[model samples]
Target: MNTDFLKVLFEISEALVTEELAALKFLSLDHVPRRKLEAIQEPKAFFEVLQEKDLIGVGNLFFLKELLYRICRIDLLTSLGSSREQMERELRILGRALVSAYRQLLYRIAEDLTPEDVANVKFLLQKLLPKNKLQEDASMLQIFLEMEIKEIIKEDNLEFLKDLFQRVRPDIKKKIEAYEGKRKENYSREEVRYPVSVQPEEKGAEGGAAKEHGKIYKMKNNPHGYCLILNNYIFKNPSYNREGTLQDGEAVKQVFTWLQFETVEYMDLERKDICDTVKEYSRKDHRNMDCFVCFIFSHGEKGKIKGVDDECVNIEDLVSCFTGTNCPSLAGKPKVFIIQACQGSEPHPSVKVEPDCSGHLEVDASPLTSIPDKADILIGLATVEDCVCFRSHETGSVYIQSLCEKMRLLCPLGVDLTSILTEVNNEVAGKELEGYKQMPKITSTLLKRLVFKVPQ
Candidate 1:
């Protein structure tokens, strides 16, 4: 090893805490064996093991950067002369991210839980884990490592963890479901892209040959799925009428129809009607369909959207209608919900300078965390939590219109739904909307890349 590389490693090792070292070791389990990692206590010895395994070296530092990034030690990344953006860009290429997304998911769940939640989890797992492993000070990461050693929760097997969480933390259980959905989606994609040669006729072909295509959601049905639009244009209160919402509805309809979805729009629905409509779709036989999508253009308050009758419906309740238990046919499939409503009453402050067409803008009220904690569900909000999203009196809202335009331009090129939404986010965020700004938010538990196939 180069002296310079050794110096860099020394600096990085000094910065990592005990918990972070444990985390780095856990993340490296796929590369290095568990027994080898168990013998390594300090960061220096761990680095030496990684070097011996040929996982990291002076010239090859990608794995080193990944380990630091995985532990969220971005500050320590400068020692490697790397930035977060650089790591993200490199990782976007398929297979560059050596760490499995499944492993990352578990690590994230560990990070999200509080100390009390961790303790609760340990208490609940008393029967499964040994007494020493379930000690008072054992971190969630350590507990998870123990679980893996006992084959309780592996990348493919999360049911055991899911069942345990249901008894302790139901919310975390939903996260596991989301992870499982994504894993299945990825597995299917791999199977499709790289099929195993079981036939005798294919025995002459080269071994390990695989397609270079990325994983995409299967969209093969005639009418791919329902694209329901609940457009609230005229409220019972005359002053609350949404002027340009019809344009949003029309744009969504045109794009989804072009994509071959069974697009339908409902005008000025009351609160009860909105709930009923979502539930009605949830009850429909979607066995033949590939996905389900819904769009809501309405005024609202925190955690709820308003109806034409000025009554409010909880967004969470509406989203939960399509959960696996409620809508079994659509289980393991994508359920997308796009809302063109302000998450809150405050306009986002702006610093950039670019003027767009001026028009009367209105605010819808709601909080950001309205989506249900279920797998294969994605909620695209018009704005961030506690911030306002703008709608033009002339054209449609910035978010919905940009989303439609990007989908039209990118879907034909095979861009996935999340990437298209990200483009919309960039477009909308760049525009100076009436001296303010709007940053769209995407909350997704989608398992795979949802690439809509355009009809021939």
Candidate 2:
């Protein structure tokens, strides 16, 4: 999105051309034929309208490839303007983008770089020259053009780049593959987390942490608590899509069985009155509790976790009930919420966007990674905001399978709090289909490292 390089390149080059008394030949002069401009503009037109549709005609494909190449060339010329400083800036930026585009073109395009091409470009980057005298660098561009056609994808100096591509390429290929396969993308972004600012809490400060009635109360625990709230078929959605809900509810129901401080399982309540069921759990004291956890398994959208009547419940409203002031039992403890729903409300491919297409960085909810603080609350979400998170007919969600697996291994090894989550994410995302792969993102804000077993 930043085009300041182009402006600098133009200014520096204009000054140098005048100083050198050189005429604008080749591209700079009006002497180049109009047919060339037509060639450059054609690809821009096609790519602009290019959607997820599979396969473009040869005519269109040729136009797009030419357009992209021409744009890259112009960007190079613009970056090298007459000023040495400006040339350096352009060289750095273009060098990075070219290497990247070269990689992308490797899988997407039919070509690779040649030895002469690589050597010449590498020289231009490492060597220093002024923008007006950019001819030194420009000479190498021809070699790049020749090398572009010959088949060669060098492994030299590309391990880091290759590793990065390995981590992300699967996801990108998934999008391309899915679009080619015409797979549906309806269940991806169901869980949306709106922002909430919580003031820092110091224990025993405000009225010794008072408790209120007729509301969901947070119970105290040293580190945290895992809870399970299961809804019967009365509450589950019965859609037939692969991503649709299952009647068993094992995902949300399994949290309570663990041997930990205070476990609660509330079932069969009015769907609209699910919060009332939570109120019932709050009043029923679990003596000597450590922390708090609430699991809501139902179907809804926006930031609201849903219940039986299909009534969507705002996540904030449900989780807010267990705050220190409201639930003294959890005054100095963390409150964990495990949500089995989508975060995104629209269609999204699990594919990672190329760096050039990196969308505006925005703050949003991820899984354990979205923790707001190094201490306090952790929200383990089901699927990323968009895309279908898989749940086997017998095994629940794929992430949960890998999650429980990691915890089985890491918890006993005394893994740090964050590291365990990290491992779980890795295990889960590692599973791949023909082209589909799912990755879970984490967000947390907990103060303590929890080893998930009886502390010896």
Candidate 3:
């Protein structure tokens, strides 16, 4: 490296430290160590202290570097007499040194990373490792690092992780179980704890080719799967009903059809009809397809969505019909549910608008049947729980319209489903009617990336 380049590196490193302190201030983290922030001015000394304190591991440092790069890149471009590519090449070289520090830190505390830290490290590894590195190596740590971030943060479930560890690293698995045995449910919220391992694949044979980086297996020629839509637009009791849902159902059908899904549209289904239809469809052979989707458009109250006859159907009961146990054909396969309905009776606070600036659960009760852990399921709600979902009678609900638009555009660009959903959420959330607002929420247990290939 040239002496001038070295000087720029040092300056940028110091600037990163300063930006970090500014970020802490903005985030209002009052207890951040002052000495630590000061030490970052001296790169070598800062890393030394980091290792001594076990503050952050290699993966985390990479993320911080990423943040630092975003913050200081424009300044670096103007100040350093180097091309953008050249600057990136040099920064990557320096990043390797940070990775080296992470490895040393990892040795000092191999199993001590928090779940969030593990997540950050996993992202770094994905960036740094050769493509197919995880696929080529199925060892315990490698597999654990490759699992989904959602799996790491799942609530009150360690069985999946334990099983995976037991299969690969029995010694560590034993220790984990022993610790778990002694633990009580009640504990201080601030205490640090070891992260649980990840669940092993339920169907190992299905994803061999998809193990490649940035690629997923998509069904060829054949329609991927069913788009089961329950459009309860015309209710027997007009007071407990919705309009514009017919249009929403048609919009969903068109989008999914373009996506190569065989759309099965239903309308005016009573509560029993909804249950019967879901069960019937779930029983069919989905082995030939890559995934499944179900969309419901109806009026609903908290925890219960209404059918055409104005009867209440518990949302959980409807969803539970397609769980891994109930829908064995779809086990280990993706099942997506997009629900467009009011989750409660209360409307969002709305104000009168000027024409110009546009904006801008279920119950089930008896018999004590156990609900299986939901895996391979992705649910996207129009509105959050206990909130009214709005519709434009002539157009469609805001969520479906935004979602279909995003799916039409992004799906062809090879964007994964979750990322597309995120964009959909942003688009809907940014929209405003008078003062009313909406933000969609996506809760997923999908293990593989789902990408639709729109034929040219």
Candidate 4:
């Protein structure tokens, strides 16, 4: 996990401080002094106060941990003089606290595990435990958290769920001991590896433009594809609130043009129109192209992006339109989706850049049919899921500008797409606006490096 992502999570947890008073009462601290509780605003101070009374326990430690994460985010983690040992000590405390509290949290989540909730739990577990190590654990919790569970969970998996329940509430551990056996089918981690480089098809001295293996390869001077830009500026639906994104659209269009793509711009589309446009675009002949680029600028919520009409389209469903199975011409080509939208509505605290500064910025399975796990696709989100992304009414989004700048400079020098995106992440994360910060998330499954070589 990226530290910036952890920082965002910590920042979000700060909003749950309303649970503080209840946490205090649950810890058996009625006898503890008010002055002491008043001083327990930050993690270290709070923990010290708890140390005095030895009150941290499973009943309230989870709340304490949440508070500590917030404290670390706002102050302790960013302090200049904090030693590595001091940081490690804090982590050790958190680790110890979690061991005593995880079962309860896990148990609560298991009681109602929607795929969305499962994704959130998985994020936490991945943060606390190494993914590979978690996979090796025969514990029912591990099995449930595995990615395969997203596809199917039937009667065969019920025993594992029962095992999880038994562990969380040990009073039933003995009663459910018979259900603690291995899953009927254990998931081995998927193997993911890519070739070093794939050569472009030879076209005479002009550069061979021949299609090989049903894949359209790029050539200098002609990209053989289009850049689809969906810029929703004059949002008709008042509920969806319009954003000033024309500058972003123009900037992206200019950059993609410089990169040798023919830009296709769509302004203020309705939700159904957005889907129809993509489906219509997918029908274009892509036999001479190297890849496809789709940039969507809109408001969004968890798992879905909204068009001007406030109608939402699941990002997965939108991207699925261009999948290899649906659009055979792009079967082996890269499909890049750059979404410049808020994944959630939470705004970052404003920072004063000069002195105070301000800043900016899921999966599941189904019954009838689900999007087949697609390959050769890359989605560069402006921010993590469920977070607001910032834009400069003056300069465009922090993400789009940085991305265009980096790609413009890096692609000409032969930088691969992933490497360019890493730089974009660094550039965007380094910026602060009105006390807010943004980080771009890149999810890619390309089997070969995707470098936009400048057409010679």
Candidate 5:
């Protein structure tokens, strides 16, 4: 290597902390083997290994830039004559980002956690790791490495880590959820780009069937479609105010906007106004659009949800407004209805386990049979029939927040709408809240995979 290049590497090495060195090594596992990385303890030696592997050189500093970016040491990129914006633009190309998003997510969680949080995490893993490895001062990155070595937490298998985080740090657990969402999306895209061969029976069951019934739905419009959010927060009854519902509205708006949808949210809509708004959108000229989405957040009783005036609106009525017969302009296009309300007044029982948050949960009632008997329609309910859903007075309803998170993470990777709802179901069902659980339900009659095309 050139003298100046060597000096620059040395300077960058000196700038990295011990935890960052470990992160750099972990991120480079795809390039360098784990056994070789385990022997290198210091940053300088790690850089030497990178040099031996031909990852960094006089003219090539791409991998080095990726490593620094993964560890969030963008300031050190200045030493290598690169800026954060330049690296971002270059990494936008496919296959240019060497580090896996999974590894980066773990490293980010490690960086965000405080020292006390690390200690608590280590304490939780006392039975899993060697006593010597779980010393008083062991870092979170080191604990992660030990977990990886023991095959407890792999890139694909993160349930153990997620469970642990739910106990000590729920916020960090959310980071994992977001990562899984994005990872699933990328996997779906990869399957589309580079399909693998399968056995005849398997192909008939999965691939052949997909080809027989069209591969993916058409979504070529500039603004792909409309995302209508019917958020009912305040009500005529003083006790019916839906606290923290605005958070859900804002979350959906942000995600759909990023997905190139014309997101419009109407807060505190009365029963008549809600029906009128749905009819207005259904009558529009949707020839230039690809799909339609609606989100209803409110309180109610079985088979219905309440409007701002404490009047009940049948969930089926809102969904029927966009049916093929009612709205011919949007015929054969996917129409999604997401309801963040309880299906009944009964609390779903679960095995005794620690809860995720301390905030109180209130319930809203509705039915699961909200979708009409029609094609290209889907209804996502917060909970199963006769079961209650949960909402945090501080955050939003569990179902809406999880759904938005999954959409924001997965849509760009081309995951279909139904598959994304499945993920949302898993995430919401996993939560234990105040001695009760919520299981989301999905009812769909779509004929083809409705994979959204994310805007660039």
Candidate 6:
């Protein structure tokens, strides 16, 4: 709506019409019928200005808007929890506008790739839909748009994007599969491909609520002793993803389901302000008081975590809430946090890292807890400051995957909680990313050693 903010984009788009010589590699790709991305290799001054504009303020907002527009436009609406028609139309208009704007900016920048700008675009796009299942939606157009962008541009802003994806990937991926399924049904002439649908073992997940509070219980109900799950998204406005809206509230559904405390799945609630759904479920279940195991995944700023309204919740909110002095249910039971986002706004001016098979190097080996405590709590982070967390175009969170892997092997072996997390940290650190590795962090305060299972 703010034309001033958008004016720069229209100006940059104009050069795309007139014949301009392509220079760099990002530009050489034939992405769309009308839109072609060429590398902008020269004009350091121009690029400097471009980068400067890309920093923060009007330009950043425009970038965010256009980026969101492109994602909504390309993901092509699908049916899951919402309507396809509505999402489709919105994507069409937005898709066209974003490409037009994107191309215009590219041309204006003389067709060279702006690393930050392009990285930002890629990051936002990753959030828009399922990056791994780009072809699932009947969105050959958006795919082309992204492909043109993806192949040419190499970026480093992916950690933020990966954190975001870890949070919303389930809903977004499910939509992509639905979109592909529908495309096959409606437009049988076209080919369709889908990603692997990795669902949790139904036994523990489908089981109902937990029954005790202070008392540590076994899987009298099912195999999963605890479920540490986190679904963090900035649900401030209607979702621009077209297919559906991501409500902070759905956390309630997950929380309630996860409340089957006897069966743990390691989902944490790092996001401070949960949706109405989450709150309502908590109230009804009230089971969290009996026996608590909750993990949060959300935006963090040092000791502070993000709430729905940009409010920050201290990291200890998760554990302290259930401390013996506070809520009686979790007086000393294990409370876990599996965070996957930034901890603060500080600029971690470290060395630019080489990409490894694991995606990044361990910036530091500092432990999550510099000191030890007696309260039973465990914490895990995706990465250190400003570093990109590796995402599987195939699996979900590397940290989580490692956690589950460790759980599967150790739980049956009666591995204690600390030992299991130790293995997680070691496995992550041992991962050879061109010899560099990601050292995961963990902090625990437990009086009783939590062995996943007892010896036969």
lDDT (10s digit) by residue, model 2, range 1-456: 113423443353443432121111112112233344234333223222231111112111211222233333344343332233333332332111222333333333212334454344444434333344334444433332233333222322333323433443444434444443432231121111111111113232232322211111232244345464544234344441222123223322332333244445555444457777665555644446655666555445656655555556666666666655556666556666766555554433445421111112111121122332324666766666554444443224555544544443344344443565676675556544323455566666665543344233
Better candidate number, 3 or 6, judged by TM-score: 3
Which pairs of residues have clashing backbones in candidate 3? none
- Summing lDDT over every window of 10 consecutive residues in candidate 6, give the lowest-scoring window: 240-249
Minimum summed lDDT over a 10-residue window in model 4 is located at: 361-370
Per candidate, the number of residue pairs that clash is: 2, 45, 0, 27, 1, 40
**lDDT per residue (tens digit) for residues 1-456 in model 1:** 357668888888888888999999889887788899989889999999987765665445667899899888899875666678767765764334678888898899899898888888888888988999999988888898899889998888888889988887799999999988977887787556333322222332232321223344567798999999999999888999998787687678767877889999999999999999999999999999999999999988877898999899999999999999999999999999999887778889998764653557777666457566789999999998888988876556878877876675566556678877887787788778788888998989987678788766
TM-score of each: 0.54, 0.42, 0.50, 0.49, 0.59, 0.38
Off by over 4 Å in 3: 1-218, 347-372
Give the number of the best model, judged by lDDT: 1
* Model 2 regions lying over 4 Å from their true place: 1-226, 232-237, 240-258, 267-270, 283-287, 345-375, 433-435
CA lDDT, every model vs. true structure: 0.81, 0.40, 0.56, 0.56, 0.79, 0.38
Task: List RMSD in Å for every model shown.
Answer: 20.9, 22.7, 20.2, 21.1, 16.8, 20.4
Q: How close is candidate 2 to the true structure, as a TM-score?
A: 0.42
Error of 3 at 345 (Å): 3.4
What lDDT tens digits, residue by residue, belong to model 3 across residues 103-197?
A: 22212222444454445444444654445643432232443333423354122445655564455445655655554553433223212221111
Model 1 misplacement above 4 A? 1-214
Model 2 lDDT, residue 148, Cα: 34
